[model samples]
Target chain A: MASARLPNLGAGNYFGLGELYAAWKNPEIQEMALHTSLSALGYVDILRVPAPILEEHVFPFMETPTSTTMEIAGTPVADDALMEWAVEERFVNATRVMVIDLDRCVRCDDCVRACASTHGGNPRFRRHGRTFDSMMVANACMHCADPVCMIGCPTGAIHRSVEHGTVIINDITCIGCATCANSCPYNNISMVAIRNPDGATITDPDSGKPIFKATKCDFCDGQPGGPACVRACPHDALKRVHFQELNPAGMAT
Target chain B: MIRRSALPFIVIGIATFAVVAWYARFTWLELGNPSIVTGYTLLVLMLMLGFFNIRKRLSMVPVGRTSLLLAFHVAAGLLAIALFWLHTGTLWPTGSYERILAVLFYLVSLTGILGYIILRSLPRRLTQTGIEVVYERIPAELGEIREKVEALTLECTEKTGSDTVAQHYIGTLNWFFRRPRFGLSHLVGGDAAGHWLRGPGGAARRYLNDVEKEYFDQILELGTLKILVDRHYACQDLMKKWLLVHVPLSMAVILVSIWHLLLVNVYAI
Candidate 1:
């Protein structure tokens, strides 16, 4: 019906209008026309375009645009401001970042308690870490994009989970070598000595030596609701954010 | 489902010492000799510790996790030290061969202890710096920063028509940029680069024109980045080089130990 209507406009209006109509029907002409129309209307602000459209159309053709402010429909829209708004709204970072908003935290230790309870009374992660403003990214296994801790593991005990990509230690296979503990730049992994059921230290009878195991957070693998620490945080201060999911270009206001 | 904790290790270590002490006393008093038993035990432990390197090499095989072996290796090492004392019955050995063996043993033990201390403390120290860098990438990163600095210097000299920054770079900062500098300072957590940059960079800034100042700002940023790269190198280099000391000495200890074992068997027997 739209195709039929195009010809009617040409026949009723002007002599050369038919040629224009035929040209407009071509895909290349259609794209050029759209581009010209948007440019003429001063709608060239890439940020104002919907994300999918901008990503598909503008981003590929444009020079990598420096983030700056531009006017859209008589309103000045700052790209950095848009990024900030997106970060708050969508939690975007080019790298995955696990952040805890400390201002919202009551420090009740429920998250720690929950983690310990789930992990047989030994909390995998510590509550302390470097803080920025009020946000404290607690000492937890980041399951880094490139895990150096995996390098020298003799038994391949520390590995990425196939399902979730969380770095996990095989408890059954883990030998308390402390290699992972030492290798971890964040000091997130720890060497723990294992004990027998009688509450005595398990020792090699021949050498009279204690046995050790390397331990760290596994991000609650196979748990129904994901990370117990995040789930148990009643104050909602804790969040397991992947920095990669965060829009790198956007800043959160 | 056993919980991992240090309490078990502490308890085990104390228990091990108590048992070893009791065994040494009983063997000396009742059997009229502890050296035969303790010496053999020490030899076996040295063998086991030597095997740890082999285990590390065969990482692809699922024989056992290296961590477990390392834990066993450390425990065995401590036990071997205790047994060495029991076997010798004195701090110093008397025979020339015995003394040589003693020297090698002590050297091995000292390095082990130092390595253990480094292993325990270095990670925390690295984290405190809050700069995470891969050991292998440090050189590449340093190269990139060097290139950036050189480009900025060239740009500053060309755009501003003044070689003040360029001359300053050549005179002072050239040595800093040539390769990783202040490595020892970085290892000790000293900011020699920062101090130098602030002093010299500030001094140079007064001579810079406004346009040159912009280029200088970029250069300063690159300089700061270089300092961080150096810090990464110092920390990572220490981590890598210490292993060089520990591993080779460990190998030498094993070799000399085997030779000593044969000598003891040939003469003493």
Candidate 2:
């Protein structure tokens, strides 16, 4: 749409992509969105067209009959339940999602170790999750499309990134109430005891309760190389992908 | 990771080690003090291997990729063994202190090899069982299965009005339901568990009436599920427990190597 808007701008003579980007940057020329501006600046990819969601996963959790039903419907290994969880949780919102091809995974916990390498000492996700014959969806945040975890935060600390749609928690504002942790159906969010730099647990000054903070996979946001877990996987086993890419036939349940 | 390209790395590593060994052999014959150089190099290699544990602990630090580090550690292990053989110059060292160091080194090497074998083979076998469970949660999963079995048994007794199924529970099936039984059987890929489930676990089936047989089938279903749990425990448990042996012995070997380093400097120098 923005490309169409810019087709006739600057005397309709576009020299190059830079001139298009410069004209887009100028508010007088065109009111460019931050996402579009970022794309023009080569910082992020702007999806010019809509992505194709799975046919079976046309409805969100609220509209679907299975929203409150926690039971596995049928053939959880690689059937309806698999994509249902993905779509219901709104995994399509994020730019990329983590997927594990279990046949290639050796259970070495290298991804977990890499995650710990990025975060401080605490590996954000366990290598265990729902599995079919070999594929496993590890218990890490999917940065959901709806982000139910963000809804009940008392302080609005857990919010999606304006630029990248990454659901991030502001540690300074997070009161450790665990609303987001509880709200997450996949149990991706973990309530960890906040610790000092010396590795001692920090306690509340009055109640003496250990200070707790909810943590999970952040998609390695702001990291220079992006998603350390995905990069550190030596075996081409792990990947950050969209739900549209998953094929049930490939994973033999 | 995948061992696809590791063949080249292995070939190059072995070739490089052979060349070093030849140089060390010449030094031993001509210079009469190659053990010192080999010992120092082995000590450094051992220290690097030990640092892998530290790297695991300080997981937050982005020093290097863990698989790359682990690959280096394995390579160092192989080279260290070759260096040890060169240092002693004989299969068994005559010196009392040297013998103790050699013995400890041998144990460490053996355990490390066993650990690596366990690491390489069991994970794919685990996936074949069509079950994925966290090691810590195995007991809870077993407990839940046991609970369901117990309830089904109660229903069978109430509906059938016979203690035959109840007696079977107290006698044979109860033992299997209690915990992760037949762990060793599962580890060796034995069908003893399935045999026991059908043979011993099915002993009461003949005594059951048509109505009672239905409940027994449900019990059998839960038993099969528990067996999958047992398989998971067997694979995951061995993978974790082997490390306990490898790590403590590694620390001991390092200590012995440190002592060996001191004694040679004190007396031979």
Q: Give the poorly placed runs of model 2, Cα more than 4 Å off.
A: A1-94, A101-123, A144-156, A159-165, A174-187, A190-214, A222-253, B5-12, B26-32
Candidate 2 clashes between residue pairs 3 or more apart in a chain or in different chains: A90-A145
**Per-residue C-alpha lDDT of model 2 across residues B164-219, encoded as one tens digit per residue:** 88899999999999988888888878878999999999988998899899999999
Q: List the RMSD of every prediction in angstroms.
A: 22.6, 12.2
Candidate 1 lDDT over A1-253, as tens digits, reads: 1110011111122222222333434447653321111111112223233445644665456553321111122243342443334234322321234566544443445567677877777888877775544455567887776677898999999999999888899998887788989998778898876877666888877989888899988888887756777656533457776543433222121
Chain B TM-score, structure 2: 0.94
Candidate 2 chain A TM is 0.63
Off by over 4 Å in 1: A1-253, B1-10, B63-65, B128-131
Q: Candidate 2, residues A1-253: lDDT per residue as tens digits?
A: 3121111111132123333343333539664332222113112333332212321233222232321112322224444645545444544343355677765565556678789867887888887776645677777887865577888799998998787788988888988999999998778899999999999999999999999998888888787656788767644467776555565554322
Q: Calculate DockQ per candidate and list them.
A: 0.02, 0.20
